[model samples]
Target: MDAANLEFIIQMLEQDTDLKEKIKDQVTEFDKKTRTMAGLLNKIHSTPTAQLPPLLDSVQPILASCTDITAVIAQLVPANQFWRWKDMWCNSLRSAVFSATLIEYLRSGTLLTLPQVGGILGIHPEWADRFTLAAEDYLHGLISLVNELSRLAVNSVTLGNYEEPLRISAFVKDLFAGFAMLNLKNDLLRRRYDSLKYDIKKIEEVVYDVSLRKLAPTPAK
Candidate 1:
């Protein structure tokens, strides 16, 4: 993780031409100082005093560079999805985006731009007629789930009944479990992307078969 984080930072820095030049300048300075110190150290091999300045000066910029990189990595943590629920939703979005992208790649036998995928998926107003009814249906279900969760959170806070809140919590957990199913679907989509090497339409068909059982409610403690 640390290596990947560092690599990503370096990549980002390298991509920014101005930042790359600055980093290169610091690296050049550090290298020059290290070489100059090494030459001095060779002459005063046994002298502790001679070795100190080069060692200290040579290390300062490297330490500063590391500190800057560390700070950048620290900032990326809050931006990463593993930290918070809102951020986790970003993960969910990524999973969805990749899945949709995979689908488009499969169907078209070529990589499609995001707007193109959105268009193929019935999202764009101009190309709505080209897509299937299933696109609208799936989108509606997803929106409905989002609205339901929002409503539940609001009601749970407003009611302030402990039991009701617990029930809400259970419902939220089940909703997460449903999302887990979607994650699994995404994993499957990724695997298919790797293996099939083409677009395959995988319908997410959720069957609702209702069943009810009467049981005594848990007694309040």
Candidate 2:
């Protein structure tokens, strides 16, 4: 190629590299905040259900900080180039989604929809032409939620919160049923989905032990 053409191409590559570095810095900050939130949320397994609201509330500021980082990332990435730069931030985004979903579920016992997850991250979920949380990432977060809930189930029983295990068993089974309807083609998703059965089993075992030991409350007939 001509010298002028080579110079132009080199400049374009250097600009792209500089942009990627900036985005990566924001993503690193985002990941750090997400890890902090996750660590705080992990206390739920040991915390009493009555004391959970305040625990969940304490992480709100960190979550808001994560949202701000995501907003900065959105601005740094050029329009129509979200997919090209997504790999740099997708993992951190997925962890952020998991933290948000877990906090919501711990607060209300319901799953956060993909749109809600996007909202928590300060991104647009409806726009296909701009930065948004990918469906795969949301699903990955749900898979993580299931795994965490299973651990919570076992821990709850240890804390003598027998009813919590029963509740978790029902919720996880319902979630697994919903997942069964989707034709998941992603290998990671499929593997994660397969692992849900094990989680269900762990929860069921907890429920069974509670029932056998007469720890869970009997139904009022």
Candidate 3:
């Protein structure tokens, strides 16, 4: 093309590159915070259930910081171009969602809704036209939570927290039931959903063993 056209194209490419670099830097920071939260949450497997509230509470500041980074990334993204650059932060966002969901579950034994997770991460949840948490990412985080809970089930038994395994079993089965209602089109999400059955089975086996041995406390009639 003409010299002016070629120069304009070059400038546009440079701007895009600059924007991408900035987004990547913010995403790196976000990922670091997410990993820190994950590490703290991992303690749940070894921690007594009575002490879990403090551990869950300690991660609140770290989780809250994610909102600020997300806002900066949202600003860097051009309007209507969220999908174009989503790959830069989608995985990190999903990891953050997992941490939030896991913390909520540990704290209250309830699943965090999409809006709740969005609130925790300081982003829109599936409704906003821009900078929203994709449904696929949210589903992926839930699957990760299932996997972690399975591990926690096994560890709870080791820690002599037999009741915790039963609680995890019930919670995971409820989650599996919820997932079964979705007509998931994403192959990865579908596969992960399929794996939920195995987690449920692992947790059930833990519960069964505890019940059979009378290690778990008997429920009040």
Specify the highest-lDDT model's number. 3
lDDT of each residue in 1-221, candidate 1, tens digit only: 69999999988767655534543444344344434433432332232433445544543343234333222322333322223222212222332333333223223324344455344323434322222122323332333333333333333333332233234334434434444454334453334323321111110010010001212245367
- lDDT of each candidate versus the true structure: 0.34, 0.85, 0.88
Error (Å) of candidate 1 at residue 144 is: 4.3
Tell me the alpha-carbon RMSD of every candidate: 24.7, 1.6, 1.7
**lDDT of model 3 at residue 45?**
79
Candidate with the larger lDDT of 2 and 3 = 3
- TM-score of each predicted structure versus truth: 0.20, 0.94, 0.94
* TM-score of model 2 vs. true structure: 0.94
What TM-score number comes out for model 3? Answer: 0.94
Residues 152-173 of candidate 3 have per-residue lDDT tens digits of 9999888878898888887888
List candidate 1 stretches off by more than 4 Å.
1-136, 183-221
In candidate 3, how many clashes are counted?
0
Q: Rank the candidates by lDDT, best first.
A: 3, 2, 1
Q: Clashing pairs in model 1?
A: 106-198, 106-199
**Candidate 1 whole-model C-alpha lDDT, 0 to 1:** 0.34
